[model samples]
Target: MRVTLKLATSLDGRIATGSGESKWITGEAARVEGHRLRAGHDAVMVGVETVLADDPELTVRLPRSDEIRQPLRVVLDSRLRTPATARLANPGTMILTAAEPRPVGTAEVERVEAPDGRPAPAPALEALARRGCASVLIEGGGQVAASFLGAGLVDRLEWFRAPILLGGDGRPCVAALALAKLADAPKFRRVSAEPVGDDLWERYDAIR
Candidate 1:
């Protein structure tokens, strides 16, 4: 599957404030652009922490049109921490957990073995592929994005950087990775860059 990691961060690459406040990192145009990207994907995935913190309605909400398609919402909740009251528990949501399967309200549940006690992305991708999902857009908090990038699973990137700055105490766009040297980092080739309101929309292809 073609996986794209979409992120909106401050000028310093901080996605949220020190206390996790990230409601308006980017402007309305940037949000519309993000929804457009979501419409182009077959599925959208996020970690459970995001569901708990952001309570995002993952459905694509664009201008009323016959061509718009809402991608499947998938959550990687290893321990099945996604509560039944979670917004993503609504109908058509898919949850991949490492624990025993259980009915998650209207959401579909799938069990995937965790590699090294963490949710493994390969199994989730395989499952999505079997379900005929050719593309996936990963909208995450931090750790989830890092996991995909660390595993070399991300094929593309859509980054929206606002003009504001968030210092070191703020949350980063990507969480920590176990890189021993600079050469171990994931590289990407810049494909395009454009202005979206006061924010900058940047696109890149993973240099695998």
Candidate 2:
């Protein structure tokens, strides 16, 4: 699957404040562009922590159009901790978990082999690919982003940066990759950069 990682953050690459308040990190235009990006992808994904914290709908909210097919919403819940009352626990949503399959509202539950408790990025993407997802958009908290990048599965990156600054105490856009040296870091080549209202939109492709 073609995996694309999307990040909307402050100038310092912080996704949220120290208290985890992440709403409206970018301008309206950037958010609209985000929805557009979702419309282009076959599936949109996030981690369980994001669901527990934000409870986002993960749906395309743009004006109704024939061309817009709401991408499948996916949550990586290794322990099946996703609440049934969560906004994403509905039809068209899928929960990939390592635990036994159980009902989470009307959403589909698929049990995947997660040996290390968390579902590895390659296997998770393989499962999505088997489900007919040619392209997947990972819109996440932090750990999920790091997992994909660390596994060398991310094909493209769509980043939106606001003008505001969140200090070191703020939540980072990506979690620790555990790279021992600078040369081991995942590299990406800049594809494009443009302004989206008060935010800047940057696009990149994996340098592999």
Highest lDDT among the candidates is held by which one?
2
Assess candidate 2 and give its TM-score to the true structure: 0.97
Query: How big is the positional error of residue 177 in model 2, measured in Å on the Cα after superposition?
Result: 0.5
Residues 19-74 of candidate 1 have per-residue lDDT tens digits of 98999999999999999998999999999989988988888887793567779899
What's the CA RMSD for each of the models? 1.1, 1.0
Ten-residue region with minimum lDDT total, candidate 1: 61-70
Please write out the lDDT profile of model 2 over residues 62-178, one tens digit for every residue: 888455788999999999999999999999998999899999999999988787899888888888888899999999979999999998989999999999999999999999999
Candidate 1: give its CA RMSD in angstroms.
1.1
Question: All candidates' TM-scores?
Answer: 0.97, 0.97
In model 1, pairs of residues that clash are: none
State the weakest 10-residue window (summed lDDT) of model 2. 59-68
Which runs of model 2 end up more than 4 angstroms from their true locations? 65-67
